[model samples]
Target: MLGVTSVDLADRRELLDRLEQYYDAVPRSGARVEDFGPLSLFIREGQGWPFYVRPTLGWSGSVSAADVNRVRVRQRELDIPESFEWVAETAPALRAAVEQAGLAVHEHPLMVLGPDVPAPAVPEPADGVVVRTVGPDDLVLPSALAVPHLAFAEPGTGGGAAGLAELGEVVRGRAGDGSVKRAVARILAGLTCVAAAVEDNTAVLGGCAEDASTSGRRIAGARPVAW
Candidate 1:
């Protein structure tokens, strides 16, 4: 039977693979990933505690105690905290391994919106509220910034401010069509607004990459990788 998330075990593996590849392509400032047989270790320097180890397909089976120890060893080597993503439906074994390693488990919603899905219209806000996108050139402006970090904070913690900016910089640098800046500018211009068509750029909204893996090249959502 399928799990609470609706994705069956077999399909979940495929989806996980795409998500992994998608994350691999993203440009993180000081984060490095190391493959260790059953899982991949992501060690990020600075911006608070680091170290996150995860298996691409946790449903494959229970990980050996030795494998879990490897993750701890790497965390100690980097002097960082221990954390990783455990899918509700497919990570039973990974979850067991981590729990055995004496780490707490937390859950967060992993949402996905496909291209074929129609986007809802932007809502109207109360009086005195304004909204719009942050223009490409205005990315450096202090007033125009500050939304990203809080929006994309770590799951349990407050926020990843440095990581947000670094990711923004990477998106900006890689932006060839000026869509990234335009999207930001639009969001900033009005407190309630939606960028209808953003092409070839990175978009941050609702605290995550809204355009991930889209043909429009917006934020690159799961569709590109999942299908």
Candidate 2:
């Protein structure tokens, strides 16, 4: 769960709008854009799942079953998995419209921390573990990324079978799928930030942390747009 307590709805709505605008404007690596009136489909070029179907930036009219049907038909034509994403509060009608189109609608709780919210204090890493922000050029980035896979796979402080070789294999596999390159592009383009925890000269665990609000209007040269 994300931050929900003591939230101001107006401020949160502004941030959500910002996020939606940013996502619509920014380039998603390994995906191509296909627009259909109120919806924009992010189709995967190769590898991985299709991105998603989302309301276009600045879309405000109520979404209807016919609207959902058009996008679904296009997705089926393209052979991509059917998926729709939006904020329930902002898109109250979309849920019903999607369900009416015979696609399952799932609600995901969202936590929006506006610029007004003070960041939480940084916690100390475990002894022998160092937590730090990872730069795009950092040699340990792949290992930093692999830590999350290891962390969830085993769910413990110990490294277990999830070590450099195993993690390296994971990284190599991502490279083949262009995930590594795309992730690096995102970091370099200021679209996201990465943090890592290192142990034994390796990011053994607690790595692959993403910093939100790393993009959108904050990015250099991007036109200012409300989310």
> What are the per-residue Cα lDDT tens digits for candidate 1 across 53-136?
767433364577678888788878777766666555545677777777777877667886555789779677434444444343
Q: In model 2, which runs have C-alpha deviations exceeding 4 angstroms?
A: 1-13, 27-30, 45-49, 147-169, 204-216, 219-227
lDDT of each prediction vs. the true structure?
0.50, 0.66
Model 1: CA > 4 A from native = 1-14, 27-30, 45-51, 56-62, 126-130, 139-227
Quote the lDDT for 211 in model 1: 30
Worst 10 residues of 2 by lDDT: 218-227
**Deviation (Å) of 27 in candidate 1:** 5.4
**In model 1, how large is the Cα lDDT of residue 31?**
58
- Candidate 1 at 136: error in angstroms? 4.9
lDDT of 2 at 187: 82
RMSD (Å) of each candidate, 1 decimal: 10.1, 7.0
Alpha-carbon TM-score of each model against the true structure: 0.54, 0.70
Steric clashes per prediction: 26, 2
Model 2: per-residue Cα lDDT over 83-175, one tens digit each: 888877667778888888888876656765445789789678779987777788777677666556655566444546655787767777666
